[model samples]
Target: MIQDRYSLAFRLYPYARSADQDATDPVRHPVVIMGGGPVGVALALDLGLQGIPVVVLDDHEGIGQGSRAICFSKRTLEICDRYGAAGPMLDKGIAWTLGKVFHDDRKVFEFNLLPEDGHRFPAFINLQQPWFEKFLIDRVRQAQAEGAPIALRGRNRVDAVAPRDDHVLLDITTPEGPYRIAADWLIGCDGASSPLRGMLGLGFVGEVFKDSFLIADIRMKADFPTERWFWFEPWFKSGASTLLHRQPDDIWRVDFQIGWDVDRAEELKEDNIRRRLDAMLGDGVGYDIVWSSIYTFQCRRMERFRHGRVLFAGDAAHQVSPFGARGANSGLQDVDNLGWKLGMVIRGRAPEALLDSYHEERAHGADENILHSTRATDFITPKTPISHVFRNAVLDLAERHAFARPLVNSGRLSVPCSYDGLSLTGVDGLGGPDRTRPGSPCPDAPLGDGFLLPRLGGDFVILAIDAEAPETMTQDGVTARRLAVSAAQDPSGALAARYLGAAPGAVYLIRPDQHVVARWAQYDETALRAALRRACAKE
Candidate 1:
C-alpha cells in the first residue's frame, strides 16, 4: 500500500521556535515553489539556471497518469529549449504541422501553421504530460548532478503557509518527517484546489461551465491521419461533442462531452466507456482502453495573483477550458515571466516593486486566456437552441468564406498576448518615432552574426545604436550591451523596423524578461541609467 507520509505539523507563529536547533535548523531559499507539476518544475529549472536555489513540493508521488494538454505552442517550445529540455521533449513528442476543423461530417476549415518565415519552433507538438514530466524530472536530476541544489520533494504536502515581511514560513510534511522551510518568496503552482491561495483569502473569480468532459486514451486500430485533430459536433446519439487526436506510442486521446446531468462515476466505468467508444467508432475496429476520466471545464481566475509574499501561478491562479489548449501553455508563460524577475530580485539586482509586475502582466494574460477559452467553449457547446443555430450558421459561412478562415481557426489555438498596462512599456512619454513602446516584448532582429533581442541571457539588456555606455552597464549591476543593426544589411526589413524603427540611432532598454523598459531615438545616458536604476530597484 502507498502510505501517505506525514513529516511536519508546525504551526504559524510570529517568531521562530528556536534559533539553535541544528546545523541546518531551517534552510531558507530565495524562492520556494509549492507543487511539483510542470509549471513548478519549469520555474525551478529557470531559476536554477540563473543560479538561484529552489525547493519544489508536491503531494503526489509521481507525474499524473494519461495524456493531458498534449499541444505545445511555439513559445512554450522556445522556453523549454531555453531550459535545455526541448531536445528530449521534441524527440518524444509528435510534431504536427496541420490542423483540420470539421462540421456536419465535412471539412469546414483547415490551418497550416508552418509559417513561411517567422517562428523558431514549429507551430505545435503533441506530447503526453506524463512523458513530459519524466523529461523534466530527468533535467532536474541532471542539474542536481552538476551541483545545482534544486530539491524535488514529492510525497510532501504543504500543511500551512505564513507570509513574513522578509520571507514566507512553510509547514510541510514529507516521509522523512515534518519540516519547516523559510523562503524569500513562495509561489503556489498547486493547481485548482490550491491550499496556499485559499489560505491567503484570494478568490478565484470566474464561471464554471455546466458541461463535463470525459477524456480517454486508448490503443485503437484505425487509419486516422495523425497530423489532424478532428472535432465532431452532435458527435453521437446522446448529442455529445467529440474531439480526437493521435498521440505518441500509437495511442489516441478522445475527449467526449458528457452532459452536466450525467453521473461521473458511471461515465468513468471502463466497460461503459468502451461500449460508448465502440458505438461511436462502429464495431470492426480493434482497440484497448488505456485510461479514462471525467473533468468539468472552468474559466476562472484568481482575484489577485499575489497576496503579500505568496504568489499564485498556473491553474492555482486561473483555469481555462481545454478547447484551446490555453491552460498549461499559459501557465508555462507565467513561470517564464516570473522566474527571471524572482531571480533578479533575490540577487539584489531588482527592487521588490518589480514583484508586483508579475500580477500585473500575468493576470492580464490569464484573463485574456479565460475570455478566449470561454468564448471557444461557448462556440463549441451551444447551450440553447438559438446558440446552436448561430453556431451552425457561423460554421456554414466559414466553409465558403475565405476571410472567415482565420476567425474559425483562432478558436482552437493559442497566441501571444500583448502586455498593454505595463509601466515599463514606455508608450506615452518616450520621445521616439512611436515605434518602440515600453512594456512591449523586445522585438527580435538579425544581428551581424546572430539574433539580437533574445540574446540577453536571463538578464537585463540595453540596446544602443550610438549611445555612450552608462557606468552601470558594466557587470556591477545588470548586464547591458549595444546592438547596432544597420539598415543597409537588413535582410528582413519588417523585423529590423520592429526594434530599430525608422530612426538611424536609437536606444532600447530591455528587462530581464525581455520586455522593453524604455526606448529613445537618440543616446540619453542619464535616462537610460535612470531606467536601469528603476529596474534594478525592483529587486
Candidate 2:
C-alpha cells in the first residue's frame, strides 16, 4: 500500500520471501543499511566492491517520481568512477560549465565553473535523481553478478530498532509477515525524516528558513542552452527568484521562490502552477508538468553522526538547503569517506577507533556545507529591507566590478571538503602545490593515455613522482603499494603541475579513498610507515 505514494520508475527490488523469514533466530549481517536511496545504495556498492558483505533495506521497491536532485559535481563523478558507476551517468547526463546570474531584467555576470581543464569529468552534470539511483542500482547488480556479496531487500520496513552493546536489533515488517534481524553495524541512510533516528531518540538541531520554493519538473522543447541560469526578482514577475536547469529526456527543472506565506495546496494545483510558468515562459511556450513540490530551506544537522554501532549518513546525519546541490553530492562523499575506514575496521586491519574518523571528518564537512547553505539562504531570502538594499547593491555592482562579483551568491556550487589539519591527516613536509596538500582529495591528472585516479584503486598508494620510494611499505598490517611516475609520463604537463608544482620531486602517502594523507619531497621508509599508521589510526 505504501507503493501508492510513489510512481515507481524501476521495480528494482520487489518484496520476496527470504530464508530469514523462516529462521528461528534473527538473521545477522555484517553491515545493514536502512533506506535504499542514493547514499545507502552507493555505500552498499562501495562496500560490496571491497568484498564486504552489506545488506540494504528499503521500505519501497525502487526510485520514486520526481527529479529531486539534478546536479552532480565533478568530485561525485570521480568517486563513482572508482566503483565503475560513473560511465553511464557521464554518458546520459547533460554537462554544463557556464552559469549566468541575473538581477531583475539585466544580466549581472556569468562564471565558468571549470575554466582550465585537462580533467576527465566536467564541472557538473544535470541528471534526473531517478536515473542517478537507477545507475547506482545497475552497478550494484553488475557487481552482484560478478560475485560481490550484496543484498537489496525491498518492502522490508524497520518497525523498531533496539540498540545492543555489540550489535543492533531491527524489527522489520513486510507484506508476508514480520521478521527480526541483527547487524554488527547499522547505518541510517533513511534520509532527513529518518525512522531509525527517531527510534534512537536523536534529533537534528538547526534553523529552518521561513520562505518556501516550488520545484516543477516539466517536459519542454525549448532551446535553453545546457547551462545554469539564476535570476533574482525576475522580469517574468513569477516569483522573488528563479532557477533553471536542463536535465535529460527533454525535461527542464524550474524552481520559483514563491515567498514565505502562501497556500500550500493552492500553489501545487496544476492550473495555478501553470499560471506562474506562463508568465515566465511566455504565452506561447508549452510544457507538461512532470512533477512538483514545495519546500522550505533548512540548514541543520545532527549533533553527532555516530551513535555506538549505529552510524548515520547522508541526509540522516546532516541536511542543508538544496540551492548548492549539496544534498546528494555530499551523501556520495560520505560514502567515499566512510566506506574505506569501515571496511578496514571490519577486516581487523585497523583499530576500531578508526571508525571515529568518519564522524570527525564528515562532521567537519557537514558543518562547512551547513555554513554555506545558511549564508546562501540568508542572502537569497533577505529578512529586512536594509539587507535587501545591500543585496541589490551588491548585485548592481557585480555587473561591472570584478571584485563585487564574488559577493553575488546565487548558490556556491558543490566542492570537495578538505580534511586538512584534521585528526587523521599526517605531516605535510613537502612544499608542493597547495592543492595537493595533505587531506586534500587528489586532483585528477592525465597519465599517459588514461587518468591518474583510476590507477589509485581503492587502497593505500604511495605516489612517487620523480622521487625514489620502495616498491611497497606496510605498517600494522595495512600495506601501501608504490605508484612511481615521472614527469615524462604526462605529455600535457598537468600531472607534474598538479602534483609537484615548483618542487623538483615529491612523494605522497595516499589513503584508500584517494585522499593525500601525507606528502614529502623525498621518500623515507620510517616516515612512510608512521604516516600509514596515522592514517589507519594505529598511532
- At residue 505, candidate 1 shows an lDDT of 58
Worst 10 residues of 2 by lDDT: 1-10
> Residues 1-539, candidate 1, lDDT per residue (tens digit)?
12533322221111222221232667777788998878999999998877788878777666766677788876677677778788888887888877788775778877776644434466778888877777877888888888776877666678888888989988776555567878888999998888888777777777879998888888976788866655647345423567778888888888887789988888788888887788678868888888787888779888778877788899999999997779888988898888887887788867777778788889888888988898888877887999878777877788899876655632557765666646445432345433347766554455545555445555666665544445346443666766544544447664556655555656677766676777777667667667766555431
CA lDDT scores, all candidates in order: 0.73, 0.92
Write down the TM-score for model 1.
Answer: 0.86
How does residue 10 of candidate 1 score in lDDT?
22
How far is each candidate from the true structure, as Cα RMSD in Å?
A: 5.3, 1.0
Index of the highest-TM-score prediction: 2
